[model samples]
Target: MDDLVINNLSNKGIRTGKQYLEGLRDDRNVWIHGRKVQDVTNENGLKSCAHTLANFIDRQHEPKYINHLTYLDDDGDRCALAFKTPKSKEDIKDRGKSYYEWAKWSNGYFGRTPDYKNASLMSFASASTFLEKGIKGQGGKVMAQNMVNYYNYVRKNDKVLTHTLVNPTYNHQQGYKGKFSEKVALQVIKETDAGIIVNGARLLATLGPLADEIEVFPSTVLKATPDNIPFAFAFALPIATKGLRLICRDSYDLGKSHFDAPLSSRYEEMDAVIIFDNVLVPWERIFMYGEPELCNPAFSATNAVVHMMHQVACLKLAKSEFMVGLMTSIVKASGRDKDLYTKGLIAEVMQMTESIRALLFSAEEQAHEDQFGNYIPLRYPLETSRNLYPRMYPRMVEILQLLGASSLMATPSEADFANEISEDVEKYFQLSNLDSKNRVAMFRLAHDVAISGFGSRQALYERYFFGPPALMASSYYDLYNKDELMERIDSLLSE
Candidate 1:
């Protein structure tokens, strides 16, 4: 009886493209060209996406998922995907399992679903309880309120939220020699009676266009200084705010037919280059300001790293499981099911999927309680999985490409099949006993997963997506107790 599908989001009182457009027409901060984006919810590219994501949130209202997919916060309202700080270890495991269930259903295509933000925000709430003295911007009263307010808003009304964190450019070391030492980063250009006005830019906001709301936070990439203090602020704003222009990266679609560019047409969720020109952050919306010391550590203290690692790892595992299933199905379809070599390859894919799942499970099961009373995934296994996933994912793609053979490249476009030349194309490319369309779909899906721009971006995202590898490795070394391991060696030597 529950409308759990992506398209059935209307029953939950979510605003459509039409409604969202009306809200943005007056927002001065948002611009697509010299002209302002009058109606984001109704725009050519932005409308469909905004509606699609709003529909996703509406699914949380259905009875079957309403219980497992959402939870009641301190205010006694049921909020979907609002992070539930586990009171016990089971809570941590349950949250991971819940996220995995969602990913399995979506096939991992909906990466920045509301659930992702909910979990991270929940962690922030849990961690804020442990604000010891002088721990940078330790006692975050506003962050706590922000989490609750945003959760409440999204719960009652279907609101789409996106976040912009990282600094705009990475070439700063070579480009800004004098400014770097003097803190030439996006510093506080000016302060105002109402709030601070910031000038500079943030990079790679991912889900900006689809979101109704945008949360700006200081990413770890920006080093703090007195000059960079203004840049250290965090605030929330409507996506259509004036002076906020999104310069999207080059389209990866390349005008290829949808069949050939399957992932690009639908899975192009990542957006880059969020430019801010004298953007104002209202006092109520500002969670942090001028406390440059708190920027990096404050962002980290939310346990966002562990949350993202868990979130994506679950999605990746789900995707890998689907991939393994498809490969096995294809092997059978191609009548190579009995071939020992083919069976070995299928088994290898299954093994990789299982390994990822095992790591995820280990991270969940061994989660420890943080000082804030929120349970965090065991850092070592989660970090290990995060580090290993980037490298292993590319190898997995190679495996798919290899198994696909030249068949992947030889597939005809959907238009070709629909045209009068269908017979000729079908005759040449039809595989062992399979229909032409079925074969094309299989190969197209493989290409989408293996070699397309979407696939390449995924590889890059996996690598630097969750912060630097060296930092991850360092955190592993820092959080891990080396003394425990050494004690075993000491015992053996003493004996």
Candidate 2:
């Protein structure tokens, strides 16, 4: 492939699904376990997932879905709805609708879909001044231009971005004493006329291997010392850039049939640690650099947290709805729908579903314009949903286990249904309404959702994806308005 053409393609209008898939065949440094993965598009554990994401890209071109998934830019070229910064209540609702469409495609299982980072990019672009505050010298104007340019590049090209914002874990004792390796967290190694050279690693890049670009930003508070200044930079770079490596975790997609490992088979958005070994981030890609004071507040200051959480709220609602559907199906298939305990468990799941749905509606209905004149979902409701869902998700999984019970354990693989003992298995496993094969398939899905490794990862992802619940709760408390209530109490006491 011609490097110049490849680099310049971002100026072209939106890529089709096929184009998106083809783009992933570029030279990217990716490793899974001990083996180097040559191409994620053809890797055994990653291809299906790559295709699933491609299908989402394709949805933008399909007439039936185009209206819901995309909108025309000011330049009159069609762009993804996810990239449209909401300026009105209707725009906020439309973005929510687009998020819903993508979330449903994965049944809310794929957490790092393109729309996730789209929210982030949109937020950063809308608040480009925040980037300016962090930049020094004559680079401030250049950095601000880079922000606009990158945002336009992504939105126009309909790029898929995965961000790595967490520092890799090293010995805390050593890190606190400034004795840790410079590579423990992503840091600028040197700056040149061309751009900045970065060498280090970042953790938990959810879709690192499959993404078109990788965003390295600050997610945690940083000390404003000179030692911490190197680690406070933020930038975006193409995944195909030389020396950028992705060390992936174990893939849950075990090449099992969809009938057996339903969720994992189609929706494993692989997480990996991103290592930048002297990776060159061109001048146009650097958003912020060397300002620790501004790094920590980048997300909050730009309102990116709220925008990203709004997308997450939509995804969580879909997940809750999926859990409800799965639980209802399990109860009916097992002929326990009439049982009081079963009804109660199902109701609990239903309540969770309705609660998330209500929060989603509230967030949109009460949406307010931010300082940038972009309409953002109600922060309080979205933050509350973020805090509550982490707690609710674990219980939802437990409910699935309870409702599934022995049926979940007794299920056989899809192959078993075609084997020599198929007759005996069918005779014994058949439910009253659902046939043996169908019943087993349903349980297999339940197992994938509640009992499998994929299920466990989902539980953990929900628990910590947005940081600690206690911190979020405290943040809500800190940010909430309490003056009116306190004043009313004082008035009553005085009277």
- Report how far residue 163 has shifted in candidate 1, in Å: 1.8
Off by over 4 Å in 1: 1-48, 72-76, 130-151, 154-158, 170-185, 221-228, 253-262, 486-495
lDDT by residue for model 2 (325-424), tens:
8888877876888999999988998898888889889999998889988898888888888989999999999999988888889988778778998888
Q: Worst lDDT window (10 residues) for model 1?
A: 1-10
* Number of the predicted model whose lDDT against the real structure is largest: 2
Q: lDDT of candidate 2?
A: 0.84
What lDDT score belongs to each candidate, Candidate 1 first?
A: 0.65, 0.84
- Per-residue CA lDDT of candidate 1, range 1-495, in tens? 111111222323333444444444544334443444655555554444455555555566668777777777565656554456677777777778778877876577667776676666556545654222222545466555654555445444455567877664535563333122223234457778866677777666776766667778766644455555555666777666667777665445454555766655555564756777777766556666666566557656768668867887888898788778778767777898899988887788788888888898888888888766667887667777777777777777778887888877877788888789989877877678687788887888787777777777777776676666776777677777789899999999999
Model 1, TM vs. native: 0.83
Cα displacement (Å) at residue 359, model 1: 1.9
Q: Candidate 2 has which clashing residue pairs, if any?
A: none
Give the lowest summed-lDDT range of ten residues in model 2: 1-10
